[model samples]
Target: MTHAPMADPPTTPAQTAARVLLGSAMVLAGTSHLTVARDDFQAQVPVWLPLNKDFVVLASGVVEIGLGAALLALPRERRTVGWVLAAFYVAIFPGNISQYLSHQSAFGLDTDQKRLVRLFFQPVLVLWALWSTGAWPRRRG
Candidate 1:
C-alpha cells in the first residue's frame, strides 16, 4: 500500500525571520510605552475616550510584551498568535487615527502630513503579523 506524502513544515526560515522581527518590534514598542517614550504613546490616545491615557498605555504595553513573547515561544501555535496580534493591531488603529486627526505629535510624527502618512502604516503592521504567523491565507492541511 502506498502512503500519502508528508506535508511541508508549517514555518519556513522567512517566516521565522518575520516572527523574530515582529516580536522584537513589539517588545521594543511595549518597552517604550512603559518607560522613556510613555509621553509619546500618550499623545496618541484619543481625547474623546474616557479611559485614562496612562492606563491605556500601561495595558497596551503589557499586552505587547505578552504577545511578543508568545510569538517567540509558541512555535506550534504561531498562526493563532498571529491572528491575535493582527486583532490587536486592528484594535489599536483608532489611536493612529486619533494622532492624525488631533494633530498630536508622537514618535517624530509632528506634522499633520507626517501623522497622516503614519496612518497608512497600521494596516501593513496587521498584515505583517498575520503573514509572519501563517494566518493570512487561512492555511490548509
Candidate 2:
C-alpha cells in the first residue's frame, strides 16, 4: 500500500501574533538603541575594551537601529536581517558575561543570580530574532 503525503502545517493565529509582536518589539527596541537609552548602552560596554564608550555606543546604536528598521521594513530581507541580528546578539554576549562576572548591579538586582538570569535570555532573544524573520526550514513533500 502506498502512503499518503502529509500536508504542510497551517500557520496558526497565535503564531502570526507572535511574529507580529516579536517584530514590533524588535523595532521598538532598536529604536530605543538609537535614541532614548543611548547613554545606558554606553555604560554597558565592557571597560576592558580599548575604545571610547561614546564611539562604541554610537556605532552599536547605529547597527541596532539599522538592523531593527530593516527587519521591520523589508519582509524579503527578514532572513538576512535575522542573521545579522543573531550575529549582533552573539557579538554582545561577552558584555553580558562581563556584567555577571563583575557582579554589576542592573535593574536594581545586585546578585549574580539576577545577572545570570539575564544572560540566559540572550539565546532566547537570538531564537526570537530568527523566528521573527521566519527563516526556519520547511519540509517538502
Candidate 3:
C-alpha cells in the first residue's frame, strides 16, 4: 500500500504573533488572579461548587502562569503545552458560564450581551492555543 505524504509543519508570522500575544495575556491574567483582581475573579466561581472560591482562583492563577511560561519559553514542548492549555480553557469554561448566568459583572463584561459574547470567545481561545502552537496539524493521520 502507498503511504500518504506527510508535509512539514508550518508556522506563519501571524501564528507567531498570536502565540506571543496569547502567552502574554495568560501571564497577565494569571498575575491578576493572584494580585489586584483576586476579588473580582471570585465572582466567576460557581455557587454550586463546594470548594473555596479563593483557593480555586489561586490554583488556577498558578496554572495559568505556568502554562503561559511554557508557551513562551518551551518551544520544543509547544504542542504539548497547547494541548494542556486547551484543556485548561475547557476546564475554566464553567466560570464563564457562571459569570453569564449570575450576572456577575467583572472585567469589562458589564452586561448580559457582553457576558454572552465573552462565552463564545472561550472556544476561540482554545483554538488559538492549539493553532498557535502547531498542535492541530500534528494530530493528522
Which one is best on TM-score?
Answer: 1
| Candidate order (lDDT) | 3, 1, 2
Candidate 2 lDDT over 41-124, as tens digits, reads: 654678799998777777876777677667657655666667788889999898788778766664454677888888899999
Count of clashing residue pairs in every prediction: 0, 0, 0
For 42-84, candidate 3 gives per-residue lDDT tens digits of 9899888899999999999999999998888876677788899
- Superior candidate under TM-score, 1 versus 3: 1
Candidate 3 error regions (>4 Å): 1-10, 138-141
Per-residue lDDT tens digits for candidate 1, residues 1-141, read 999755324877898899999998898888888999999999988898899999999999999998998898887778889999999999999998998888898889999999988888999999999888887785469
lDDT score, candidate 2, position 63: 76
Q: What does the lDDT read for residue 105 in candidate 1?
A: 89
Residues forming the 10-long window of minimal summed lDDT in candidate 2: 7-16
Best by lDDT: 3
Candidate 1 CA-lDDT value:
0.88
Which structure is stronger by lDDT: 2 or 3?
A: 3
lDDT winner between 1 and 3, please give it: 3
The deviation in Å at residue 36 for candidate 2 is 4.3
